[model samples]
Target: MNTLMVMGYGNSIAMSQILVVVVEILLLVKIGEPLECKRKEIVTNTPVISSNCYRECEYPSKPTVCEYEFNVVLHQTMSAHCGDCPFKKEDCNLEKCVPVDGSSRPLIAVNGSLPGPSIVVCEGDTIRVKVTNNLQSGAGVTMHWHGIHQTNTNWMDGVPRATQCAVARGSSFVYEFIAEPAGTHWWHSHAGYQRASGAFGPLIVRKSRKTEFNSNTYDFDLPEHTMTLTDWADMTSLDIALKVNIPALNPRSQTVTILMNGKGERIEFFDETGQIFKTPRQMFEVEAGKKYKIRLIGAFIAACMTSFHIEKHSMTIISTEGGEIIPYETDYLTIAQGERYDFVLHANAVPSAYCIYASGYGNSSCPSNATFILKYKSSPLNNPTCASYAVVPASQDRDQYMGNRSKGMFSAIDFVSSDPGDQELYRVDLRHYITLRSYAIYKHPKDPGYLNGFLAVDNVIYTPPLLPFVTNEPDDSDICQSTLNKTFYYTCGMKQCVCTNILKIKLGKVVEIVFLNTDEDIIQHPMHMHGGSFRLLGLGSFHTKKMTLDNVIQLDKEGGLLRNSPVKAALKDTVMVPSNGYAILRMKAENPGYWFFHCHTMNHGERGMVIVLQFGEPSEMPKPPLDFPRCEGWEPK
Candidate 1:
């Protein structure tokens, strides 16, 4: 990586060089340009780490640009059962096979690696990623920077139909943006159900850990401590989504396993002499008595609420959604789709192997669990006796999987933001009440017979428009409603009404959105925003069974709403709205452009649980580049 060098800091430089620097500074000011980090390339094995990359967020004088070239390819798994290979092994040759767990299933890999590759850079550095689509299946793709706030570069938000069109098959798209508000983040496929097939990776914008608010909580923040958790199924994501959409399918969609760091399946290895070698599972080796910062990513495509914990160990969560929070100690974490958390794990337990477990809600079809080994440097290489991938006993099951398990489980309201400036979030200027429900899509618009059921936000199903939201001049027919209200807008109940649902907000308004999940089925929806994160002010269950949108508004006005201190409210880009409950989120409408606000579940989002959160007028937003590609639905005469 390129580092900006200066001859002197105070008086160590020659007079002629100092004069040249002064002249350059004056020239830069005259042109109204700010200094940028020079672009550099580094090759590495792990995602988000390079030996030549900047070590501290405060170093290099000026930011250094990070560049990555990714080729999205369709690949297949290599080994199964006892032949599964461990992650990042030197002898894990991929010349003929790609080992992703023990299942020889098809996957959409990036450069032939599951979980893609990592992108790491210091805050304020420019990130330029050139992605070439080589799926060979004639499928288009788009990559969404999960927690990156695309400030001025709204076109790079990567939401197909909202920010820009999908990079078509065999085509390429270069995404350029400046990384800001550094924290743990991730990236995944934004087109179709490709993320379920492993088109995702870690995206970390580093800041000096020593300068962070809770930096003192952890002793070491190493690059190898990143853990990405994903729900996996035997079938491809497209096929799973198809089964989910069909009501007659016995179990809709199935999540058979959960993968950590792209490694699942507790399989054993053996030598040619028939002697047992070692078990292949994602292992995090640590030293006893040391505190390590572990970045956890919830990259699951399914809607199951997965709980993560290391046996006989506790975690102190320091940050989430790229925003630091006051350290909150918890036994385990219930993570939702598209969420990121950084916690400090103290390795003070006995120097032996322990089970790093992940358990989903214990539903027969959609629920499953997986385990990895957390081994100490002095521990043996064998698997832990306590590391059982089988069903956990009720006494050992910490995730009490009852309906809306909010009584004992830690919720968003439990976290407190460390930033003192977040007090402005509580001063809401506008309030919006959105109710989650399901509507039927009929075979014919006028026919009573329905083909399938689709989820919706605020009673309106989102249909991608023929034109992108940023470039299109949408009229009455394109949008579901011109104006929304504090309560319900238009009710499409069981009728088929799908349109572009865009909610406009005035620039700089502090908005409060109350999301109510009134669906009869017990399910959690992780609601995520594209442009920026928000303050998760409150979360609570409804007290009355007959509560409606108007009732919720009146309850809030009557001081019946659940709210924490505004100065210490939790900041998150995605908040899981509990089943048959509610979540209150507050944020300042600072980012100017069209942004996507949607349910992060893959199938739900694919079937229209999305809306556009438009800030400022269309004329005030940034425009796409002159040569930017444009596309629309196919038209035939």
Candidate 2:
């Protein structure tokens, strides 16, 4: 590993003790394809100590042991720059979107921007933000730092009713935590359907944590080249939530409109007064023959998936869900709702403007498309031979370090010398061979046939709690728990089956989950996990009947299940269970807290298909903030 030097700070301490730092400088002497290796840390800085890490891998075979290091550094408090993390929800007017249809809809904006504001920071920088709910009188709001491993501060997971209650309406909530594993991530309101109202934005963390890092990824990483694609509705999110289950509002037939940066190439932007201004299409400009890093985020609350593609450019996928992945080249990539992807774009093409297109999928209703431009500035109309290096754009600037083609792409990622974890059969601790088919808690029949109102886990339904489990009080009760008497089914408002069902998991146990997408639903399910990421063990073939736990366990015993990848790399939080097939996933319950696992489709999770995985002893977890906001009255609207 390359030696890294930390400087600039006058004090001995770093950011904060709880800060997340990727200490990538570890020397490992490999023997015969990773036969054996040891890791030792030499602390060179004061005001720092180590803690137990949640990233632990206990392999029973050729063990894939990871260096467990939780270095804490003390320093002055940190604050987000006003320019990056802009304001209170009510005070900002971040977005003014007018789609092609010329509709004036209300959206949750930040600093007056539609897609909210981008929180850009470096690897080790801690973040602090104050979010105020300025919506209706009693409307509640809570922000979930999507794809971020909250690490030691699991209470700051921002999951209402689980980690902490929602920040009540007309209230303010402060979120402070460390951000790690630099790449692309986003934040959105976890309260009700608020995210659908535009309560979401990009959060980027860059800079290598290692002293020596790979550069040849891209020539220039223009932070300004950030954009978002989402499914937009003219009606309020609450209204949509109320009517979504109705036959008239059947999602199957209601194609939605797609927008980029909250703006589409619709009727030129005209205000309520019938005035028009330049409705600029989302665009990115780059120097001719230059390589650029572009971050793409999906914040679709209604749509299930969106396929993104550029007219004349191929994207090199370098990172996924805030973690660097095996850099792979592809023409197009499908981004499900709530997922982020970062790719390098090489403007090697002759100087020209190219169309960046995105279309939402999985929904026959509300179909939408967003188009933007990737214009190369100052390209010779005709191919010129003699080129002048003449001080082209900034390069080698640490900020522009998102560079180069990596030769060891396979080393740390897929091209690894060896992976001991793959040698042993899957033995994840949850013990239960869980098999779930995607279904619905219908507004009418047991099987509504189409994705209309509420979606539920075919095996069970989960209801978000009114009170958080992260409080000082012990959680000795949950609706899903079997009572001493007969199995009790609880109901809240109009639903007889809605109740909180928490899936308790032991810490450091290997577990496997097989999701079977039933044919009852016409769409695929993009399942996602919060607080913890899983290894995609395998994707099975389409099955007509839902396999029981016994059957899956039998298949594993018989070596019928597909194992690890042979060529490509795998580490992801979201995986799509085919419309009539299944996806098997494995993971170690390392993090100790209430972790949410659900389908990424916002509407699907809001209604059902949301399950909580409780790791470790609840009492051992960190306590909620002293002034933690209570969401007792903030029930589903």
- TM-scores of the candidates in the order shown: 0.84, 0.71
Which tens-of-lDDT digit does each residue in 1-637 have in candidate 1?
9964565566555666878999997887687341222222445532332223546677433566666777898888754421334433543444434554555678898867877877777887778787889998989899999899999888898888777889988898989888876888998889888888889998888887556898788888777899999887777887777665654435544437788877777345565687653325688989999999999999988877787878888888899987898887877677888989999999999899889888876345555668888999998754776544543335423223222223234556778788865557658898888888765565544344434778888888888877776677566677764354422345466465678888889998998888988656366788999998888878876533657667778988999987877667877899888776788888899889988999998988888889888888888888878777667567788
C-alpha lDDT (0 to 100) for residue 442 of candidate 1 = 57
lDDT of 2 by residue, 423-507 (tens): 3235444444433444444545435464464555535567766577776443455546412212342122234355566666667
TM-score of candidate 1 versus the correct structure, residues matched by position: 0.84
What overall lDDT, based on C-alpha atoms, would model 1 receive against the true structure?
Answer: 0.75
The C-alpha lDDT values of all candidates are: 0.75, 0.58
In candidate 2 the C-alpha lDDT for residue 519 amounts to: 39
